[model samples]
Target chain A: MSDHLPSTARKPGLTSSAPSVVAAELDPPTPRKRKAPGPRHEDKRVAILRTAAQLFADNGYEATSLDKIADQLGMHKATLYHYVSNKESILYQCLVLSFGNLDAVMSEMEDRSVPPLQRLRQFAHSLALAQNNVFGRCLVLVGSRPLDMMPGGEIRQFQRRLDETVRALIVEGIADGSIKPCHPGLVSSMLFGSLNWVPRWYQEGGKLSIEQVVDSFMDVLTSGIAAPRR
Target chain B: MSDHLPSTARKPGLTSSAPSVVAAELDPPTPRKRKAPGPRHEDKRVAILRTAAQLFADNGYEATSLDKIADQLGMHKATLYHYVSNKESILYQCLVLSFGNLDAVMSEMEDRSVPPLQRLRQFAHSLALAQNNVFGRCLVLVGSRPLDMMPGGEIRQFQRRLDETVRALIVEGIADGSIKPCHPGLVSSMLFGSLNWVPRWYQEGGKLSIEQVVDSFMDVLTSGIAAPRR
Candidate 1:
């Protein structure tokens, strides 16, 4: 979804009194064009996505339909189509955004100045917070099972890239002697498994903040539950 | 579904030629009766459940139907009703069995003479292995979302009991000084989250055995991945 409005149109001055007089002097007033796609358009699209993701997470993917989403959004079915093509497309976008959050965390890891252990902790904190969002919860609860036959295969690619990134981080940690020697693949599975399961039990305004949960998990993951050997 | 066949009917001797002569001497021969529900009936019921679980895990519970399960098992759809009332019943049974496995682990933990940390490790190992089974995978993948409104509320109760058991173990470990002091709730969530996620990535005949996977998880849980402080 592209918005081709001029960059000058986005300036706050255009909507204020002083800039309008200057524009009037510059050129004769003409019939105003229909409202262009702008911030409001993007906001509405995000609203539709958020509503759809919540429904999909609360009710399952198979049980949630576009009509229900439209009803929830108080938009006509036809009007809803202007924002999202279909239910599957909404789900696809939600997953894309969900994985995009993880991808951003991985991108931040490219700054090698941070030690692997700290980078891993930062990644865990970011991932836990991301998964607390509606789209992230939808990604975990509804999952890609419904989209197995969907054409793009982008979901699978995102999954593979995520797996590789986690494993690579663990390997780096091991190499730098920050992480204990272990099976990177298995350790990554445990890490992802623990973090991904967070959505199933995590409550937004519950007792613990996302930071606290991540901190507890990181503590357990680093120091472990067992008492130190005498 | 109960099988009320006589205990004598279960004896292997009754199926053997030598036992038939002893039975003839014991009583006069009469008209043969219809075959009773014995080992074969139990075997068939287990077969139906296993087939249904596989279908539910692979195709999803919403997408899977009793007819499809029958087709996969090469049995008439009506015949499936004899073993399970409907798809919901099959899912309930699968969850019952899955939770039953966890309950058994908790029961094993009742032996308090073993230190709490050792008991926690045993619980982790048992949980990971249970999740590797088809029924366990069904519980994780298909879930109770489909049967949420089912009348009995057994599933919810089972989940609560499981949460309490894990938390209790963590508390006990902390009291005994076998485990590091931490928030039992957060630690238990992390523990269950990690173990429950096994069904997602674990392949039965993949590179690692269930024991190996469990061992790795136990290692991570006990010692963690961070290298020891100098």
Candidate 2:
């Protein structure tokens, strides 16, 4: 990412780059209404989540329907009501599943007394892992929504908690004099932003292991190899 | 962004940090959404772009609709047909407008035979500027859709063109011994991914200038601050 290798070259590297994105806070007119009733079933719940994630991934959240999801699962439309009450619930659940793992990773970091910088490396690894899963797209889509979803809501506050945790981690690093004192928010943004965007360009069965990618990212992100005196 | 800040006396200085989004593109949605064909055409066109961008940004491309857009605009459903024939057209226009300026930025950078590294700095700045606007969200939404709008579509070809362009730029620096020979794809992704996600966090009336953010990004991005010792 350094400057001045040359002004012109043979190929554009990441030039085709574009960002990509979910959910049921959408309000299109309903085509049909069905009575909401069903038993609390577990398999049905899992099926609903799995189906909704696909639909949400494919069609976006607002355009998907409980009926369509029900149809995909080969179940009655009303039967979906028993498993998940509304499309919004499905949206929230998909989000919870995606972001929930992030919280777990951070907590695990807390359990260790690793130095601040090492902890940051742990964050990069965990973040890459967390964002690379099925829940990754769900996380991107859900986070894109600009609505003031209830501040107290789990999804909304969950991000806040995560932000605080990341910031605290960065702060701890700075205080120990092991990290740079640049804006932690910007640093955090750069850190997670790099990880958050992995889902956009990364393919599942590709050349580099997740570990190699993490190391490369850390090399560029943390300690640039260009010696100042040189 | 260092790795060794200690854990004690965490006299946190980054607490006031608010994550700022240095997104990739931000444009008002394409002009006119009224499909019904009627009075105040100009107003209607801009209105459609406004509503559609919000919907697409919040919802997703396939999920947002002409009808929902009209409803958001407070215009009749049929009125939307006048401005755009369909959602796909709106998506294309929204994106084309977002990309329109990029071509200009590259051209501006071309006038001066700046060092390849400086050219990259200029590239990063222009990209960061594009993201600071309304079109950034538009790019993110439409960029995700897997569209084949034209027969023998060059979406694949255009992406190739873009890749070639970036690769050439990077290779120039490498050949000139100005930058290292790293994975161009990974570097490209890291630079863009970090820049594109800026909108998700940055507020319009924030403390930092676009250049400040850009330089900071380019600093950590291009050359890490770790001073080397003998």
Candidate 3:
């Protein structure tokens, strides 16, 4: 992944090949130079994570290897280890990274103070976008199998928290009289299951856009599949 | 699987030690006795399939092997092969068996001449039952991967046919004014995804019965999640 970084930000091995004068001009000896490594390292870490995610999605989590990820990034296996301690670490970080983004989106949605029904629609759209995105697709395709093997149960906890938030949204909708009164837990499961499975059949340039799919799902959820009572 | 067979059906190697009188009585020297191989062979085949399905569910299809299955059955690998051609064949058969049973149930539901809404409710219950069953759990866990490797396109074709039937039900419901107008393809995907994911969380003797889950799902599907308009 670092291999694709701008020549200036790439490892010294490649950057050193540039004319010495041009390199010297780009980096002036200053205290602020210390801040450069932080963002540069973070960017490289994300790049490795994104690449690993794509590989995990393409060839399942078990079948994928650290060597394959490094090969895909055009980096040495040693350099790959610098970003991630091991394959499981990569899997762990990939899941956390995707969930972090999704949690952030949900947090923003919560802050909107919209009606519960409208919140549900926004939540559905965000879920569709996140799952269909390259990173989240890996999370859904691999499911929670990686978390089962990993230590500390953080992933499971994080997932449970997400499920609870979804249930809470539904409960709120029911209270506000915007959503029908139903078993919040069951309805949440149906919503998540449907959203999670979107990546299974959704094509990038497919006939239906992600928004269209979300609209269709949300419509079905809000409006009974049965005709309105006469 | 053969190890659990009744004494009368036990392989000759194990049953030979029976008292001569009992053995003679069981065999009953007769011309028509030669025809017994038909039902006996079919029973052994079913035993092998049931055992294979259990193993496949416990351990994934790829991790399971012919040797392990034969060992589980307390039979020689050669004897196992006599019942099944190979491991893939066992997997292929396991999928076909489960899907075949579910397909039969759906067909029965279709023939009831009930309203589309009622038929959908019946379909939901049958789907939940089938997925929670031992055989159906194997199908959900292993997923359609085995079908991809299996020689014929029969499994995929069978699956497509099922999907079409589901969509047909929704379409019929819409035409008959029992179901709301919606995208049959998208709604069917949502319905199947929710139903299929049931095995992931449902425990047979858990707090909720399969009937409860089915009823909850059907309620949400038929009635809109939002409150009825005043």
For B3-73, candidate 1 gives per-residue lDDT tens digits of 22222322221221221222222222335875544555556776777788888988899889888999998
| Tens-digit per-residue lDDT, B12-90, candidate 3 | 2112221222223233335544544355666677678888888888777766888899899999998886667676666
Query: Which structure is stronger by lDDT: 1 or 2?
Result: 1
The count of backbone overlaps in candidate 1 is: 0
- The candidate scoring highest on lDDT is 1
Supply fnat for every model shown: 0.71, 0.42, 0.62
Report how far off residue A20 is in candidate 2 (Å): 29
User: Which DockQ value does candidate 1 get?
Assistant: 0.41
> Which segments of model 2 are wrong by more than 4 Å?
A1-44, A142-151, A224-230, B1-83, B107-112, B141-164, B225-230
lDDT of 2 by residue, B3-110 (tens): 111121112111111111001112123356634323355455655665787687666666676778888888887777756666765665454444435555555455
Of models 1 and 2, which has the larger DockQ? 1
What TM-score goes with each of the models?
0.81, 0.70, 0.76
Q: For candidate 1, what is the TM-score?
A: 0.81
Better of 1 and 2 by TM-score: 1
Off by over 4 Å in 1: A1-37, A224-230, B1-37, B224-230
Q: What is the lDDT of residue A177 in candidate 1?
A: 69
Interface RMSD of each: 2.7, 2.6, 2.5
Task: Report the lDDT tens digits of candidate 3 across residue range A41-87.
Answer: 56677788888899898777867899999999999999987767777
